[model samples]
Target: MAKARSASQAASRSKQARKPNSLKSAKTEHARPDESEGTVPLELQQKCLTIFRDALRPSADDVAVLQEVKGHLYNRDFAAAFAKEEYLRVYASRWSPSRALGYVRVLADIQDHLLPDDELARLGQSDQESLEIVCLGGGAGAEVIALGGWWSVVTRSMPKIALQARFVDIAAWNDTVETLHKQCVTAPEISKYASAAAREANRPMLSGDAFSCHFHQQDVLDWPENVVHTVITPTTKLVTLFFTLNELYSASIPKTQHLLSQLTAALPANGFLLVVDSPGSYSTVSINGAERKYPMQWLLDHTLLSDSQQKAGIETAARWEKVVSDESRWFRLPLGLEYPIELENMRYQMHLYRRLATKGDG
Candidate 1:
């Protein structure tokens, strides 16, 4: 007889089981459908289960409530230890796939604009190139896996460029990040969402694509401004922050703006910042004794973009673009598992700020 799942596991599985299956069954009409279009893939789920062994154990209602309160009000590294275990468990099984879809969508948009003609062809033809990416508050590393997997899928028919990403968060999640890296770059069987053809045509990217990640367990707010510039090269550099800026801005808008100022100042002429965050009031906290929702636009226009009058600022020549999504589908499968995250009807902002090249920029 098979062993039974604990109450928490059963509950989590039950939640994931509720995912829509109608679209997933139309495989005949879909050849290499985007992974965002349906539900999570089977191989992907099994891989997550295999890699992240930490499972969510049931806790008392009072303890759960206290922990939830603490998470909203306290520092992330100091939050409940048991909750972190549960979080990592949920992250591998749930949040990673959802966010990966979003990343792929935004990436597709960027590719369409940047490389309108033969994007995949260029991906395959380009010699090995390196990029340095810095992701803020990315301890669990869902975003890193997403970027690598998306690159693999995007260049499935071609060769992949080299990528070296640095993740900064309060927790030391390098082990989990490394495990995810292995799955994306070397072990491709588990990361199905990367290549849509993997499910339809049964071809996974080979292990030699060469994507690596580094981890830094430090407070992003306290990070030195020029650190990213110091570590990057002449390659196409990028800075990413997913679902993190809201918290920083909530704590202090000026601090968040300062961070942006430093990052944009240090960005090379071709460098850019990509920020993905939800639009809501639920994640809000008290700022100067007044409860308020996340201020998305003010930060973009004021913090990220400087006034044209300030011609001396590093970001004065930069451009900011924001996209709000109501519904857009990628590839997902009906796996009948509940992983404690709402994967549908995503409502968030995808913001990109690129530094325009200027003369005398070296």
Candidate 2:
């Protein structure tokens, strides 16, 4: 009986050893994808506080500017919304850590469906099929940093997959976004947040090589011509838009259409476009210079996507499909020092869409 039990134990060990790498990696990615890493936990939140104070080192004026912008955004002060580009940079510094968590959570939700296969993991650092991620109007490179953070937590072995991320925005945030993205990858203080989130969840953390990000400054008005050069590849796996559409839509739908059209077309079959925007109108809306109200969903559903689809000639079967729609509370301050809205009321809609994979082998 002793020998039989020992043989059984050996068999069990063999079975465990035979499990696929993807299974282990999948578990790592989901480390409380719905909790600590998803919503900024108090401990990780505290970590952000330290980084902002020591590493990021926001000045008194930066703080004051951030506060004033918040009040203006909350009060619907259009002229003051983006009065100074520096204000936009400061805005990102204040909110990106928490926003990064949010982006990771959403990405984790549909990660399985993101690609046709898990080959990216096995082919570490190979340019042959390096995964490309593009972010439109990404202020201060929040999505890129968040993705790098998520990538580290999921595959802890010095970059099991190669990633080339492109962040496109106006010139104002060019330097700021590039610098911040590099900081998140290199800075020990920023890395602590990922370690803390994993530790808090009692999950194993793997050390991985950092992903690379490139910044492109594009004029929104001229994006139709610019996108040809920026996102000119079929391998682009994902296009992320965070807290940007409302501003773009508010400014000029036709111009926004050109950018969206280019991005939607540039996607590889089976790619994804993630749009995460504040749900309600922080301000009013106007369609064709006629001032009125439009729900955030309606604006995207009827106004924006509809127009882009028609202009881009996107087919019905191959058009964008909504995959995830869920709301989570966001922090006015990632440190959790300030709750811009009550915990329950500070809601952000995380939307995911999968581009149709193929059309009759093209």
Please provide, for model 2 over 150-269, each residue's C-alpha lDDT reduced to its tens digit, 9 standing for 90 to 100: 665445453556677777765355565556555555444434446666656542122223466777766554655545555646777788777666666656656666666666667766
| Candidate 1 residue-wise lDDT, 146-240, digit = tens | 56655555444454556677777655566667766665544324354556655565433335445677777666566665564554445546777
Residue 359's lDDT within candidate 2 is 54
TM-score of 2: 0.66
Clashes of each: 18, 8
Per-model lDDT: 0.50, 0.53
Clashing pairs in 2: 156-206, 156-207, 158-207, 158-208, 158-209, 159-208, 159-209, 270-357
Which segments of candidate 1 are over 4 A away from where they belong?
A: 1-78, 81-87, 114-128, 188-208, 232-236, 281-294, 310-345
Which regions of candidate 2 deviate over 4 angstroms? 1-55, 59-62, 65-89, 115-127, 187-209, 282-292, 303-317, 327-346, 357-362
TM-score of 1: 0.65
